[model samples]
Target: MLNMLGISAGIAVAAYGEARFDAFGVMLQLVTITAEATRLVLIQILLTGATPPPAPAPAQADRDVEMGLLGGESSASRPVMKPQPGS
Candidate 1:
């Protein structure tokens, strides 16, 4: 809030110095235009936050089913493959 006021004051002073009073008024309009756009963008980003989409649910397996649809049933878990940069 205060930051925007500072910016407004600075622009008013500078525009008045560089141009006439009418031109300064025109420049001030631009300040409000940009400030409004900035405020809206900030509000949208803040409301959304950094939320990630929910992941899909895992497929449920039946213990009594005995085997996978592919007929491959392993008592041990699958090995986790670590990636190598070159390979």
Candidate 2:
């Protein structure tokens, strides 16, 4: 809600600036308004817990490596070290 209000205020200010200026102020304000609107939309999406679609599944080779990591097998193929005698 606050983000929406901020975006609305920015647009209102931009409109006022455009009306009062005869130079490039209007163009700059338009850019500002657009940026603010974009920010507001992203914020709203985040606050609403919107998530991007899941990525496609990995290839068979990639999945196999990932499984090996989780299955207690190191991908580097290094032998596990044993504990030595304590000091």
Candidate 3:
């Protein structure tokens, strides 16, 4: 809010200081500045408004139940096999 006001004031001052000021040029500058500011504000709103979903604690509980049903042994709990002494 303050930043935009400062930028607009600066442009107005610059335009006032110019001896051969062009109304159309100043109008275009103001329009472009407004558009860019709007774009930035919208982007900030979208980024901060969105949030990721929470962790799946229920899914982990389901997996624990499945492991219990499977004789307390899942593929992940199995030990790796070592190479035989021969062959």
Best by lDDT: 3
Residues 1-87 of candidate 3 have per-residue lDDT tens digits of: 999999999999877869677899899999999999999988997989965577657767677679989868654556899999986
* Tens-place lDDT digits, model 2, residues 1-87: 999999999999989966786657667879999999999999999999999998655674576578687885533455777889994
In terms of TM-score, the best-performing candidate is 2
The per-residue C-alpha lDDT of model 2 at residue 43 equals 99
The C-alpha lDDT values of all candidates are 0.72, 0.80, 0.83
- lDDT order, best first, reads 3, 2, 1
Candidate 3 residue spans exceeding 4 A from truth: 1-17, 50-87
Winner on TM-score (1 vs 2):
2
RMSD of each: 16.1, 16.4, 14.8
Stretches of model 2 off by over 4 angstroms after superposition:
1-20, 60-87
Q: Which rank order by TM-score, best down to worst?
A: 2, 3, 1
